[model samples]
Target: MNVIHAENIIAGELNEFEQAIRLLKRLHECKARQYLDSWCKRGEAGVYHNVMRKLDRMGNIYQPYADHETEITDWFPLVDCIADTAVYNLKWLGRMGQWHPEALASLTAYVCEQERLQAKEK
Candidate 1:
């Protein structure tokens, strides 16, 4: 999943939440769904489920990974969704004054390149 690459991406400058989201998006795009699902599962009884519930209680949104059995067979849509969500979240953070706009724009451009690479596979 190249999780380390994802972790190193933020350059240790962004907020923790931003870093986490970037890592999550990278994992999603890299087809590390199982890893993500596993990551979310670490509490008491059903820790992951409990964490999700707690996040829900706090109004923090968490996008659940697609269940392979019920998920669409196509990969493009999934990649597109991941890219779109990351870009959207980046823009949102910028708009909310949580991140520098110029920095966000640069990140978006890099993510766009990732999108282009994904598109070429199809």
Candidate 2:
């Protein structure tokens, strides 16, 4: 996993972290049920558990930022954690041959948007 140090985060970059959290929450709520249903029907509950686990990890990583609104330093790890979880979840879904088009699109869009923001920073 790539670690993003707090000192490396630029001013205003925390907005991207906030956006990522929102996107992850939206993706989880929108797709978790469908994924759970599909995985359960296919007797692949383990895969659903993995996906939800990543989402839970993301929530845990973001909780600090959500709780301390003024503490932008905490956003550094949150950004990397969100990125890692999103990428892992997408890859896991793909590997399981359970990719939902809409969910994939949302995840892809989040990655692309994050990349764009990072590029602008550089």
Residue pairs in collision within model 2: none
Per model, state how many residue pairs clash: 2, 0
In candidate 2, stretches whose alpha carbon ends up further than 4 angstroms from where it belongs are 1-44, 96-122
As a whole number from 0 to 100, the lDDT of residue 69 in candidate 2 is 55
Candidate 2, residues 1-122, lDDT tens digits: the string is 22333444554555766645555656556666566444344344555675577678778776666898545665656655665467445546564444457766787789999999999999
What is the Cα-based TM-score of model 1?
Answer: 0.26
Predicted structure with the largest lDDT when compared to the true one: 2
- Cα lDDT tens digits, model 1, 10-62, are 56567666766776666555654444444224322344344344445333222
65 Cα displacement, candidate 2 (Å): 2.4
lDDT at residue 25 of model 2 (Cα atoms): 57
Q: Weakest 10 consecutive residues, lDDT, candidate 1? A: 59-68
Candidate 1 at 15: error in angstroms?
A: 20
TM per prediction:
0.26, 0.35
Of the candidates shown, which would achieve the greatest TM-score relative to the real structure? 2
